[model samples]
Target: MHEARSASVPVETRAADYLQAASMTAPLLGSGSQETPAVNTYNSACGELTVLLRSSEGGRLWNHPVTLTGNNSTYHLRLEPASHAVWTPNYFTSFELEQQIKEKLIRKENIHKGVGGALVGVRKVNPPEKFAPPRGITAAVTATLDFHGKDATLALRRPAKQPTATVEGKTRPLAANFSAPMSYYQPPGNLMFVGLLGGFNATKYPAPTGLYFMQPYDPDRIPLVFVHGLFSTPFTWVQTINGLQADPEIRKHYQFWIFAYPTGNPILYSALRLREELAKADQLYPNHKPYIVVGHSMGGMLTN
Candidate 1:
């Protein structure tokens, strides 16, 4: 007889109440008055009320605890000051909290493997935690990937993108996939190479293999491989590759290489083919250090 798989798994749930959208009018408080509080939105399942604050100039101010009064369809809020108030309009029901969590998990998973992809089913689950203010409001986010059916945890930290060079000294904005190559050569040891590999069909017009090199000063170490996500090409890593190349600390450790492929293909098929290509490359340069594969988005999913 075939065994049946267990149906229920515990999921860790975390709640965050943020000011989704709000507008500031003449700040006036009180009931039965023409003035009303600014409205924000949130995601909640149990009909819980969470307070959110907004600044008149713009942006969020603070989040507080409040009770959600009224029926499930429409929520009514009362502020302590009762004067000019900040309210969340139909807050709890309008957001896709679960989907957001799933996307976050998928992004986190890709970071470790140096790839990115979509999140699938949950193998295991845990209880959610209440929202806490993060350290840097404008800082880049760090993602944590906890895979189900496995005891592995992957933490991915991606730096935010800064402005890039303009075209012909003009202020023309550069595309995310601009090409920037930096390479180096090491003497006696294994050669460490790094850079961005252009995707197969990137430009509307035919483009050559775009390889952006980031080699160590010594040049004799095995290079690390960086794989990009779906619909993304080697150009996506231009900023990251450039930063790593410029960092003296990173330069001393290893070389870098970017792998670009046609994102239109199936992820597994691409990965399998990539594995074979890597094998062939390894044969050509036996002394080169083994590659450390990194993929993003769909590429991340493929790595697994």
Candidate 2:
């Protein structure tokens, strides 16, 4: 009779050991404060294993085309900071980075096994300073697998200098000034009204007052007026005003004015009213030159 041979350790147990060893050496490989090392299984045409990673520093969040090796699929991962800056408050606070990595792993696992899924187990390694005991600093690795799919995701949020506030049942970051902008207008009141009128006998006027002036004080340049069409307002030219103010070529030649009007009024009445307004401008600012009128849509028809 032959002596019974001692049984070897199971493949799964050996694999777990290899993973633990690799995780232990992860810190030695990178100098950054955040590190993520995760393993996932996929049965696509490519292969059965997939690994994803993101450094504490903002660089490549996902490392694709990763290959696995070893008897039980033990793999080593090493990452370098994308820039010289420390991977701290700049990109992601320590707490945010830790949370991100944990979530990433949990998502990966769910994509591997084809069964009912949820986060099963999670383990944290070395966390950042913000994450202490009560506010523990550590990495969380989670496993999730479901009948539909399996995957993991990681997230990190670090402790702040000033503890945040819980307001209206929601935690909000502390602000230097917690005041809302003051408003001059009150709602639910008709403090403003809209109207339109037309008269064929209205004087054919020129440009209006304050229509022209120099870059520093020129009198020859023509003033341009922009009239917006339906459902529009003076705010439309805000960007144009800013651009013209900055450009030496355009700024030296013209001054821009935008007209806002109610859209519900009849198009013909608005146009006739606009023509009368232009005549008045021409009469008031004779030195400014007859204004160059620009109108959009209905406004264009009126100006013509």
Candidate 3:
């Protein structure tokens, strides 16, 4: 019978090789700089993997989402020098774009596995000129994403010439009049749940106990205040806030507020405290419209 002929099998492809061979095109924004009299432009139009932008003085400028377009493939984009009430530019403006493909391209290769489905192909741009409206020629930039035989133009703009009207009135100052105490933002985890039966010891937890807000107050959106039950902190409503914020219509029509107090307090005392807080808030904000109050567990009796 002798030695049988050895079976020939092809080696399975690796993720790196599959990613490297991904069928996509990279346009003008790439890896090298071309200096000129007026502006310096960098081109990495081919084989571009990643790009990053950092302020010369290390300032973090906010970025805003404009839109996500295309089918079968999608592009995520952010505008440079995101206009903010606080953060200001110290140097040149920058923007970023990423490409994502939904359908699996290679066999046994999972894209964005364990990474929350984030897309790769990140492109960062730092225009040589400042973002302010024109003193010289406009800095033109183009972005394109192609996948599954579909091509999408991500962003194309002359930074100095695009109208600035879009950013106006989009948001308000979050830390000024509508700020909440630091503890409200940090949920106490299991301690919050255990505190219910712990009585007066519940007050010992580090988180503050009082009224709090999830976002800056807006006159246009009616406030929906939530009150938590015995042994519970305002943190209990975090998931509810998340769910509400996910619905664009709900988020647009309402602002979320939370009321936290020591569960050990008498229900009548808690109710009285809530009434006082409401009066104070109404006085400060001075709106003619009635407010919405929701409560859970013992807090529900107080609400009633």
Compare the candidates by lDDT and give the number of the best one.
3
lDDT of 2 by residue, 52-107 (tens): 12321232323332222334334332222222111121232222212122221111
Report lDDT (CA) for all predictions: 0.29, 0.30, 0.38
Please identify which of the two predictions, 2 or 3, would achieve the higher TM-score against the true structure.
Answer: 3
Find the 10 residues in a row with the least total lDDT in model 2. 176-185
Count of clashes in candidate 3: 3
Q: What's the true lDDT of residue 45 in model 3?
A: 18
The estimated TM-scores of all candidates read 0.32, 0.29, 0.43
Q: List the residue pairs that clash in candidate 3.
A: 30-44, 31-44, 196-231
Best by TM-score: 3
Put down candidate 1 lDDT per residue, 242-277, tens digits, no spaces.
555454345435666655566655667677766765
